[model samples]
Target: MSSHDVHDEHLPAHRSETTPATEPIADPGLPAHQWRPTDVDPAAEKRAERQVATMFGLSAVCTVLFVVSYFVFEIGEVTTTIAGLGASTVALGTTLAGALLFIGIGIIQWARKLMSDHEIVEMRHPAASSDADRAETVAAFNTGLEESGIGRRPLVRNSLLGAIGVLALPVPVVLLRDLGPLPGDTLKSTIWEPDMRVVRDVTGTPIRPADLEVGDLVNAEPAALFETDEEGEPLVEGVELQVEKAKGAVILVRIEPDDITPGPGRDDWGVDGILCYSKICTHVGCPISLYERTTHHVLCPCHQSTFDLADAAKVVFGPAARPLPQLPLAVDSEGYLVAQRDFDEPVGPSFWERDSR
Candidate 1:
């Protein structure tokens, strides 16, 4: 076919001359009003009002019961059980749910039975409001208030108010516990101490400078994690061990001797080009070991915070505000790597009490 004929073939066909024009959909007008039992009968209306009030009353009672259960049921150790769940957990969950559920049900009941039942169509208009529309909105709000009968139904209103006020009590009641034992100097210190062996993580084997070659990185922790007291009990165990392990995590890296540029007084920090730094990222405390052997840069996988290990673990290219806290390394009498001293500064993310700078 000719190009013109091909173009014409692809063009949309014109409407048929016999085709009828499309008609607009007819509006389905509102159905005839049906009066509810509460609307027509004074007795039913009074009963519904009492029911809504009762729901709100129950909400307030549940709120009080929630507070009581918090104290009555010991949180730790399941001394009691309800359907295989801890008694304290079940009591707290049920009471809190009851407090919220009853308040919601009371409001739904109040709207369905007591609030104005008249139905009216709202015509769609421009979304941008004019001055007149704003005034109309305020007027509509007042009309809705009047129709809701909040002022007339003092029982429902007062009960709902009381329930809401009681609900707020749980906020402080739960939050006050979290004020907690102050962190003290915990964040500022770790299990690391002078002469503490830098042991390989998981295996607890002490590391030596000879064990790593140039560009090698080994995740390490303080030896206290594996040591024992005079009585043969673990020096650090349970939750205490876990907390100290996290804070005391370190990474030992071996770089070329000439590649390292130590900061002031950090000359002796590394032993034979082997240096130790916190495994925790200075940005948000995510453990980082993504190392670039060529550039001597370690990247935090969490936020892409890069630190140059050769440059005293300085922040190189990401959101980390400070250098990774370095641990001074030394050789013990056994020739195993050990910490000369704890880090001079804190490790991990900044907290409210610490000077972030």
Candidate 2:
């Protein structure tokens, strides 16, 4: 008896057991194939073929409509609407969805009702293929292509081809004009000049050294966001205010004075235990400042990129290729915390022109 059989023999009669190796297992062949209506009925086959072709034709119509709608409506015109959404948005979205959805349905119906219905059986084999196996695979691929009858059905084939060709036309049509003009030198600078007060992001109240405690992390922006000029006109408003706040976003963290390891020529960058760094991640421009007070490490939520805030915000883990840029800080004559100047390096994800290590 085999080892497994011997082991089974030692078990009690009450134990659950399987058959012995000495007995042979019979093979059960596949069930008989069932024919579909489209397979045996000539009328049904023609009907299915027409259905798939009709779907493909509709897809082509939707794509053509999408292209037409692109030029039909003005972007910001408030006069027209479909259920409160812009007429342009509703038209573009519905047509594009229909274009993709109809093509997908057409392909699925064609495969199910018109393509080859033979059920294939493949035996388990070693991963490495022999020369004969490769030749047989190529022969089977050619056989499948012939069985699909794509060459015989001119209506379905031509409609599908036309739909696919028209689908790609919308890409360049929207990409060329949808996005506004280039950002030109706007990203290279911020409104944070020398002596600009660092204010709370939402409250817009200026911060002092006394306002922060050890292990405190605060989100801040430049005072120019909320302040007014001599004539009482806002310093910045609307899109300009938004752009400046996005570029000047910063995080102020207070660590133990003894824990800081400042970079060269940056010894006086902090006051007491307070230090400031950009709130943007270096990897992909995600906003950061998820702080671990014990380790003084801030994490980017998007990609989990970690930066050691105590040591010039140097990246310690994750996909970030560089450290968070440090913003120099000082106290104004009014005892409010202020920026010594704009960040020495650009603050955000690395770009082609920024090669700083």
Candidate 3:
């Protein structure tokens, strides 16, 4: 419809009569309604009603086939192929798609061939509803329900209900399959242990106090990441290495010894001017490395959560509610930086157990 072709009922009586001819907005009345073939003939009406019922019945059949296909063809069984796609995928997808598509078609047919087709203009009114307004709304809803004819057409209504009921059966089955083994105390600790050498991330070389100048920040991880067995294969490989490194990552920063403000029982957590804290942000566990050396503050680029590196890595600014967990640091006899012990408090984002600490 043209922008100016709004119905004449929408035009205001106060509209100017003296407006220029070209400037006057066109006011087209409601378009003429054409009756469908089913509306004009008794036989055509019955045929259309039957067609809608047939589509709904087919939808029910497809839903039944979906369950049968689930057990007949296993998930990983690729021996049987249809057009290079797995037989299981083809059967499950086609049946499920048809189940949804047929129901949509049946609803469209019902609305187009039988429902009310009158058009009426409703005037604007106050937004709030009173007792009288609520009564009228309920009356209108009952009138619409009568017009839908679901009460008289058992074939169409019952088939649609049956198809929808069968479609919901797969949900609980899939959810039960996805709930694997439970996790027990896995998230409470990391690979860090007593005397674990703190090494640079990319290069496996250990860090020393002199290696980091004052106002310097270095990204480091536990030496377990680069450890290998006698066969020259990783001691921790695959998903295990990925999970450990993510939790064990830390940032080493150097500040004046007097600038360090220790939390309770944390005075010995640092060595000389060097302090080590978990790189993971407390807000949502993003890797924090963006450091302002002058302020001894590191910012997480993911959400701009800044942490104070010198003052026990307390939350200086942003959305983080807790301070970064400090890793107790000690020097080994060989003059390499090492973890005195695993962090007293769990690292990463807060969990159920962290609240008690």
Cα-lDDT of candidate 2: 0.88
Worst 10 residues of 3 by lDDT: 175-184
TM-scores for every candidate against the unseen true structure: 0.72, 0.60, 0.62
TM-score of 3: 0.62
- Return the lDDT, model 3, position 168: 73
Model 2 TM-score, all chains together: 0.60
* Each prediction's RMSD to truth: 10.2, 11.8, 12.1
Best by lDDT: 1
- Kindly list the per-residue Cα lDDT of model 1 for residues 1-357, writing each as its tens digit: 899998877766663235677999998888989998989999999999999999999999988888888778775444677788788779978998998999999999999999999987788989999998999999999999999999999998999999999899674667476464445577688888899899999899988788999989999889989998899999788778988998999899999999999988899999999999999998888999999999999999998999999998999898988899999999999999989988888877866676522
TM-score for candidate 1, residues paired by index: 0.72
Candidate 1 local lDDT, residue 123: 85
lDDT of 2 at 10: 89
The residue-by-residue lDDT of candidate 2 on 1-357, one tens digit each, is: 899999988888757566556866677777889998999999999999889988988998998888888888666534467798888889989998999999999999999999979888898878999998999899999998899899988888998998898887774667566774333455567788999999999999999999999989999999989998999998898768877888899999999999999987899999998999989898888999799999999999999999999999998999998898888899989999999988877777876667533
Candidate 1 segments exceeding 4 Å error:
1-54, 67-72, 75-84, 119-146, 151-155, 165-169, 172-186, 228-238
Give a tens-digit lDDT track for model 3, residues 1-357: 666676655777767345655776688878997778876888987887899988988888888887788678765424567898788779988998998999999999999986766777877778998898899899999999998888977777887787787777773474365473223455568899999999999998999899999988999999989999999999997768988999899999999999889888888888998999999998888999998988888998988888888888888789998899889999999999999988877778766557413
